[model samples]
Target: MLSITTFILLGILGLFLYLLVKYPDKSIGTNERPDLVGPRGLPIIGNLIGIYLKGFTNFNYENLTKYGPNATSTSLGFGRLIAINDPECIEYVMKTNFENYIKPNLLKEALNDVLGDEKCGDSNENWRAIYLTQKIFVKLFEEDTKKLLNIMEAKVQSGETFDLQQLFFRFTLDTFLKITFGLDKNSFADPEEPVRFAMAFDSVQATIDGRFLNPFWKFTEIFSEGGRKMRANCKYLSEFAYKIIKKRRNDPKALKNPKDILNIFMNAKLEDGQYLTDKELRDIILNLIIAGRDTTAQTLSWMMYNVMVNPAIEQKMVNEINTLLSNEKPIPKYEDVKQFEFVQATLYETLRLHPSVPGSVKYCLGNDVLPNGTPVNAGELVIMSAWAMGRDERIWGADAKIFDPERFIKDKNGLKPSQYKFVSFNCGPRLCLGQNFATIEFMTLTTSLLRKYQFEIMPGQKSPPDFGNSVTLPMKDPLLVKVYRRN
Candidate 1:
């Protein structure tokens, strides 16, 4: 009787095993089987529970090891996500097959909300125009960066160590506004100025970060108070930009090409040979303001933070700057300032560690397979987490997370990853247009600030600012350092 009952139990167990294998969950198991395995997740939510509820900091090394080089997908509320660390695969997506991917509607709309433009409008052209305009103004910016250096020097001399990040934001905002739109509110000195368009731009960045957390709350116009404020700020930015453009248009001198971005923008003609409307002009200008201001400010903050943490890098930068300007005046002229090697290395390292626009989303314009054999369907969004890619041990070797500036000098093969793998400015046609402009600004601010003061982390102060792991990493509190004169 025992033998017969045991035989019956074995039969039932075999039947249950057969059902489990035949009818497995479809989300984790690919529709058409692929060469990758995703993290085991809740039936529908996948990685969403970890991203929003726990924050990225909570899942650092553990997640990467479990998920392989490319491990982000859509489940729960995350529409479509992809995190990549393979250099060969990233090269294919960003370069070899670049045309197949473009920024999606959701991203474009978030940027549009920041600039007060329509959701489905001709957004690409405006970004292109801004890129073209910044190319013209980069020369002018390298020229105007001296004034910002002098201003920073003054702040250093006064013995007031204010929030360096905020100060850099103000400086870059002033530079961008003046050079791009020919509107200068001088908000660097007075944060509460009525025409503080930079604050509006910051509001937009916050909204963009918020969207990533809870996508269900995505129709930002319907829910966010910050969104409403951003719209209002966009209104102010538009009016201010148009006022300048109208003034230029009425002036006879406007016919001639002036040396700034505003002149080129004013005189530009579209494919149809019609000039941009005031609304388009405003959107384009605001977009430039945010791109130019935020990227440079974040980079400068990161550079300073690294220098403070790694005293060796700071001394090297100071020595390089002093040696280059040794024969010249104490305040190095812009032409003379280009000779600093260590400073350049410091900037490169900072960009690697904390890229301002860390990661970006690329929507597949059509169906395509990445070099790593991951097939992306049309209309699907694939996100390249630049932050994750930078910190990957495979890419930068064992010392990936440590703040070391010398890694950029040379590798064993004497090849540089500056362009392909460590892509802060990105690569291919869609690369950052303001790359040179941002570098020059970072070089100038970092050198000038260090020349006047030697700063130390306050007692018990952490090395890098606790940025709370947002879309673009930012300081949880303002970066406050104790300052001392460079005697």
Candidate 2:
């Protein structure tokens, strides 16, 4: 972080540079809207030093709460940033006027390095069709889900304390690969043994996250060790993808599940009737991995922690699960999982509090006015902070910060979040393709865990909800816990 003195010096230099160049203003050659409120700052890097000082989560909260649940702006040297939390404004940006808000240059720069390793389509019509049509084989994931339960059973029998986040990471990784790529090469069976591909993929996530926070990536990236690590990790990930693609091309078993995601994509034809190139295929799988992996695991970790923190909620959810499985002790199938509304509410509540994707940045493709009466200019970046939105008092009443699943349970429509309110899966054109798969994966694991085991948060851990600066919000510290068999 830049010191206060240094920030002032940079502000002076920034103003000098601002005088040399001309940039468009919102109104009267200045942005001084009462509705669009934020802390006053210099000509460029507006309030950035303050943001850096407070950290991302705190910065978001301060702005959203202090400025009201509307739109606020902070102009950096490169571009202007508008932080928006209002649901109506969020809806406008996410859905109503979706085309106008594309991923900004900052996001592009952060993701550019790994783009070529090319894992996932940028969600064109063709990509969306293939993604939405592909039915994830639930049986495959359920089978792996059992393996995860068995592993947990082992931990309990051995009386061992464990990091819940690491466990979920391995489970989600394997489960995602199994359904998406028709592969079952999970090293979560022995997490301590280390999986090169998994570790490398994780490195890619952290490295990408680092870029988001880096204002000097354009200059510093070339000389930094983090940059080198990012490059190496990208290579490792691409090579790993290529190897799977190669193996699957020759193996008939890859098509064993007719609805297999990879098989469907591999067989899919573009508008020109040409099949997706190897690069495209690799990218698609990579996209699925990113979409499916950390988000669920992190959300699961948060759900567990929140439930542990509030035991009555956990008991109520377990009761709901038990009611659904009253007659038979068999594992809940896809249809059966739907009956666990309370379980869903518990998870949804967690999402509201600690959304896996904490914040999103979208570039304004055209000038437009937000519903809250904030006029935005073309080329400015708009940051939609789900983390902050979930905590907005206007949206959720005074107890917005409270982890109360009952809010969702009573509302009936709460689980199906209204447009911008629950954006964990996002909304509109760019909503997540893997939403169904993720929900089922969580249900299968969560429901089964509740059926057989009782979880307790282990003592002496800080339990600070410090989120890592990744694209997907993960706990910076391990969530240690102990488990016992239910009678």
Candidate 3:
């Protein structure tokens, strides 16, 4: 029996060897090709042991730099996952043959539980709707939300100490819902507000956490913990959207010609001169809610933490706000916020230090070779670690880790950003559509707080909020802020 078992194992090994020798492109071994092999991994499990043990923090970027950008591959599972760190190689993948790489099915499956079926999360047709609505309506109408800004400023002026992260998250959530869905679920003021949509938003963070930690939760497989929550959330969100869709479809009187995202969508006609389905509109609304709420909230959390840690920079910002708004009326306009250059720099520096979306995963559409001569197969997963890339010494220079906003003011050639290097909003066709809108919101919110209250970190507290993985990086601990109302 033992001899027979040994014979079978040896035969299988021999077959694998034969395949590699016959077709080098199909196998894991090749000297002529740049393959990233670290230490030996177990069969089936592959290098999951390393990934599981290291988890999030154990992900070593230094190892990649030492091994040439294209030379090293991280063993994810059945396939060898390629890691591309070089800026030129990233440019090639993101721009050169942009369509050849796309968001993997796994991501879509995971996000679909939260994002809905509209393909709004997709880079294609649905995204076009999102881009049009956001660019034309939301971004263009920066001043239209003055009423909302007035409310937030009033709340701040009343002298309440609040968690800026949660407050801003709720603010954006409410703003996005009103802007996109025409529903004013003021989640910030009333925490117990039973907005079914807020519950749906929770699925995004959980799914993001699961994507990094659990390998079993593939896109197609729906029984995973995160997947289950996502499906539930989607069902609720869809039902709620269907109600609105029914109202809009059945009753033309219900459709308000108000200047909001949904109103524009109601009027939108495709290139073929056809109207979009109710499901399409709902999906678009849900996508914007997720995008506007989580990304901006997380970015603000990191920014607030940075302000607390770097008191000098924080004071500079406070001084700028006070000096600018001192003589003027307390209620500042959106244009008034633009003059505070230090605030802009601080936000840029925060994005540099802790980008909301650290990495993006793309699957090769077909066979392609990276700039470093690493061949990527059609189905292999390519991870572009934005966090690692942001902190890359080659790009950011010697004081990469330091919280200095001046770096953005000057580039490596001693000029401004060369268009590709500072990619917090990404680049190319897939660049963030709501970039200007988000910036406006961020600066406005920051200006609102800076002009009045001063946030100082409590003694013996960790300066920057402890970062952990979710759809967006948020505070592991509540960002405890002590507020002193500045006249």
Number of the top lDDT candidate: 2
| Model 2 per-residue lDDT tens digits across residues 274-341 | 87777888777776787788889999999988888888998898888888764366468867877888
lDDT of each: 0.66, 0.75, 0.65
lDDT of 2: 0.75
Taking the tens digit of each residue's C-alpha lDDT, what string does model 1 give over 269-348? 77778877767776667666777777788788777777887888788888777765532444444455456666777777
> Regarding lDDT, does 1 or 2 come out ahead?
2
With a 3 Å backbone cut-off (N, CA, C), the pairs that clash in candidate 3 are 36-71, 36-72, 36-73
Which residue runs does candidate 2 get wrong by more than 4 Å? 1-35, 75-78, 115-136, 251-259, 326-328, 412-414
| TM-score versus the correct structure, for each prediction | 0.82, 0.88, 0.81
Better of 2 and 3 by TM-score: 2
Give lDDT tens digits, candidate 3, residues 1-487: 5798899999999987775565344223322224454444444444566666654332535445555354333344325566667777788788888999998776776576556575433435544555555544434334334544454456556655456666666767777767776666756456435556665666556665666656666653366565676667667778887787777667676565544666666766666677777877777777777777888888888887888777788878888877766535543455565677778878878887787776677888899888867788877777776667677777777787788876765645432344356667776667777776787778776776677666765566566456755766667666656566565
